[model samples]
Target: MRTFRLYGGFLGAAEVMTKPVGLTAAWWQVLGAVLREPLPVSGIAREMSLTRQSVQRIADLLVERGLAEYLPNPAHKRAKLLRPTGEGYSAVRRLTAAQHAFTNRVSSRVDVDELRTTLAVMERLIAALDEEGL
Candidate 1:
């Protein structure tokens, strides 16, 4: 569909900007969520609407690569809290800076209010799709 194409194009542009740091879209999403709040693997999975197993695998890789760490979760007997290491923080900062620069460049040519309205519409569409289990 036309909307899918538009979404794909937007994702492609984001990939081009973020791939240099070896961060896939999924990885970035997981990392960004973790950065906002240190969470157990189950918490991250629930927040991101992903499987816990999948998130654990990625978290394991991040830990092994020294980008993230697993610390004992005091609130849970078996869960481990996931937190970003210094390297992960640095990567996030770089990725966000690049994204901001790209957005600023594009926004300079467009009316900011129009851009915001378009984003609101797109977000509504995404929420609808999510509600329908798309």
Candidate 2:
């Protein structure tokens, strides 16, 4: 479908666009997910509409690479929260800067109304998908 093509294209673009931050697309996404508030891997998976196993794997990798750390959770004994490390913060900041620059460049050549319309359409599509279930 055309929409799937669009999705693939966006992912490809994101992979290239995020390289300057010194991380792969998934790494940048996983890092960004925790930059504000630390949460358990399950929480990240829930929020991102991703699988728990995948997020757990990425979380472990992040810890292994020193980009994130597991913190004690007062509410739960076993599910420790994943928080961004100082290095994680730095990488996220760099990625954010790069994204802003790229957005500025692209926004200049794109129609804002068209973008808004696309967002509306995508939101509707997501709602439909949710209603239908995977």
Candidate 3:
């Protein structure tokens, strides 16, 4: 369907943006979760519904780039809590601002309530897919 094609193309564009930033969608997702709180590797993996190994790799990359740091975790003997460094927080803030600006620009041409309703529908659809094991 044309709608599916458009949605796929939008995802492709998102991938292109991440490519230049040395991040994949998975990495962004992990980083976003880390931004909320310092989480152990297993916690991050579980929150993102990703394999621990995959989350670990992304966390390593983030640490290497000075975007994140590992802190001592009292609760876990072997696992360290992950937290965003100053640079990481700044980067995420900028990225969020850009996304907000883009959304505002796009919404300028459409009714705000319509966009909100559409997003709600999309959220429900995504939830249904998850429930169906998609």
What's the TM-score of every candidate structure?
0.76, 0.84, 0.69
Return the TM-score for candidate 2, rounded to 2 decimals. 0.84
Better of 1 and 3 by TM-score: 1
Q: What's the residue-level lDDT of 120 in candidate 3?
A: 100
lDDT ranking, best first:
2, 1, 3
Least accurate 10 contiguous residues by lDDT in model 3: 13-22
Q: Roughly what TM-score does model 1 have, to 2 decimal places?
A: 0.76
lDDT of 1: 0.85
Pairwise lDDT winner, candidates 1 and 3: 1
- Output the better candidate (1/2) by TM-score: 2
Q: Candidate 1, residues 9-112: lDDT per residue as tens digits?
A: 77787788768887766667778888977899998987777899999999998898888999998899789999999988888788877898887887899898
lDDT of each: 0.85, 0.85, 0.78
Residue 113 displacement in candidate 1 (angstroms): 2.1
**lDDT (tens digit, per residue) of candidate 3 on 1-134:** 98899768766655655565656555567778988789998999876667899899989999998888999999988899999888777666656655676557767999989988989998898789779865
Q: How far is candidate 2 from the true structure (C-alpha RMSD, Å)?
A: 2.1
Order the candidates by TM-score, highest first. 2, 1, 3
Tens-digit lDDT string for candidate 2 (28-56): 77888988899999989877789999999
